[model samples]
Target: MDAPALDLPFDAEAMLPGLRRWVECESPTFDAVAVGRMMEVAARDLALMGARIETVPGRMGYGPCVRASFPHPRAGAEPGVLVMGHLDTVHPTGTLPALPWRREGDRLYGPGVYDMKGGNWIAVEAIRQLQRAGVATKRPVTVLLTSDEEVGSPSTRDLIEAEAARHAVVLVPEPARPDGGVVTGRYAIARFNLRATGRPSHAGARLADGRSAIREMCRQVVAIEAMTTDAATYSVGVIRGGQWVNCVATHCDAESLSMAKRQADLDEAVERMLALRSATDGVSLEVQRGVTRPVWEPDGKVMALYETARGIARSIGFDITSQSSGGGSDGNFTGAMGIPTLDGLGVQGAGGHTLEEHLLVSSLVPRAKLMAGLLQVA
Candidate 1:
């Protein structure tokens, strides 16, 4: 397939070198040091673009967030565009060796490539292209590269909301939809911590004397999985318990996540999940709530922004559609807060949060042009 005739100067081949650097950085969310390194790499690129950079120190043991404000005629005057993205990925530090950065046909494979690093780079490149051509944007542009999004924006939720409130619209460069669509709405997501406690005893000598917390937790997991329905789904992805095989486990813990199409349904799911009790007589269960992303149902303002982006896509020769994605992103915060937010404005790709993660090489230029056009007009 050939790219549509667009006037933008963005070139996919030209973007590869820098994009490779970003993908190779391997900034996983849980590793603050790795994430910090990724921030530095992005900072250097933003600085080279003549953007005024601010490094907001990371709180709660996460890495710092990079906020780059591009020079504009209406600099810091009114609410402008906030292009938000996360530099972190779900892959751990050693993932690079297994999923090494390489190109296969039209795909660029690497750790965090399709999940977000590629999108973050695209945001910067959009600004770079505009600056290179001396094209002035209608509003000020601020790119906020956050450290956490894969594990929920725990350290950056307040920052994302605060910065977004000061902007007229938020554009998130999460991986684009398989159908080449942008995101206008996102589902509500809730995280939970579950703990089970029970009496411990020697497994070999007194198995019946012990009340195993792991056993109770196993029951809880089954029950939690059974709670899934068409409106909302529940999952327990992480679980830890037991010190040794010779002793009955005294305590067990599990992490859960739930997503819903609507806020009300999510609230109901949350209540139900929290209400769980230990099935065994001597065991006790506890459920603690974690960070949440409110349901971002698209409103008139959001739809209007989508209309503008759709028109821009048409000008570039290919039409674009908008979607309400099941996954969550920073757009959930901004869109839910009534700010006009557009998401999935990144490279076309598939296989996010997996070893097979990759992005279409052909999507770089068009997506960058789309981002640049939005920076100019939206």
Candidate 2:
């Protein structure tokens, strides 16, 4: 495999300022006000590259999603490529005080630097490079930055899928693997909240008369845990019950996280959950199941996209490999829409969803170059 020719004139200095501006803006998902401000910034930056930008408002605490695009200069070339990322961070307001970004040698440390802000900036820089170099492609490019990706994209999945269906390719800038590989497939996730209610009685006076909802909850937990198999995994992440140590418990609830490789596996898990019956007679159970996101299966289109990405990476003096991850991202939605999607194109780093999250500063230029090349090819 030969390296792709790099024709774009990359401006590292220009990208630095844009990255700083984006990172400084607090775009936490739960903070609609702050996220709105961040979207404004993104819109402003994107406008400079002649992208037509639009903001879609979200409900309640959810922030707005920004959709921006730069059409191909030539008409009727090919279906455009859609670059997907999120503007919101998991950190809430005041978290910046604790996760202040620092430059230690070649690493950049901050709350959302590696998790995605850095990747977002890279996408912007890549577009800038393409515009500056006057690279003409038959395919146009659209960037979709949402506000609720970290929290499972509950409100943005529909928008993502709809947009993805209109494109020939979807590029996700989620943080790449620590070893700098792309993510081809990701596991599917299903979350359930189970509540059991039973009659309450005095523990000392009428122990037999009162049904134990807590005990029934334990039985359900065991049954759910038993569903975990080689291809699927389940966890009882949270459990709550009992008013006091002495009082008879009348209510109980448990939250479980389930992961599956296929739809059949997920169906099996859900069926098992639905089959659960109260251990004690007269006790009632209620279950609320929610699917946070669907799995990104590795199909023919995805495999072809990976090959293109690998060729582009090699063109930039790097070798690229891809693997299926148990983790999910916005790419899952795009892939489910039958679009060829490639993810994990951001700077290499580790420790997402933690205080130690960081990015390797050296990766910025090469990754941006790779993206610029991809845009040219698209």
CA lDDT scores, all candidates in order: 0.90, 0.82
Q: Model 2 scores what on Cα lDDT?
A: 0.82
TM-score of every model versus the real structure: 0.97, 0.86
Q: In model 1, which regions exceed 4 Å deviation?
A: 1-6
| lDDT by residue (tens digit), candidate 1, 1-378 | 112224657888889999999988989888999999999999998998888999999989898999999888888788999999999999999998999999999999999899888888888888887787777777899999999888889989999999999999899999999989999999999999999999999999999999999999999999999999999999999999999999999999999999999999999999999899999989999999999999999999999999988888877778888989998999999998999999999989898988899999988887888888888888
TM-score of 2: 0.86
Model 2 over residues 68-89: C-alpha lDDT tens digits? 9786665236568888999888
- Residue pairs with clashing backbones, model 1: none
Highest TM-score model number: 1
Q: Report model 1's TM-score to 2 decimal places.
A: 0.97
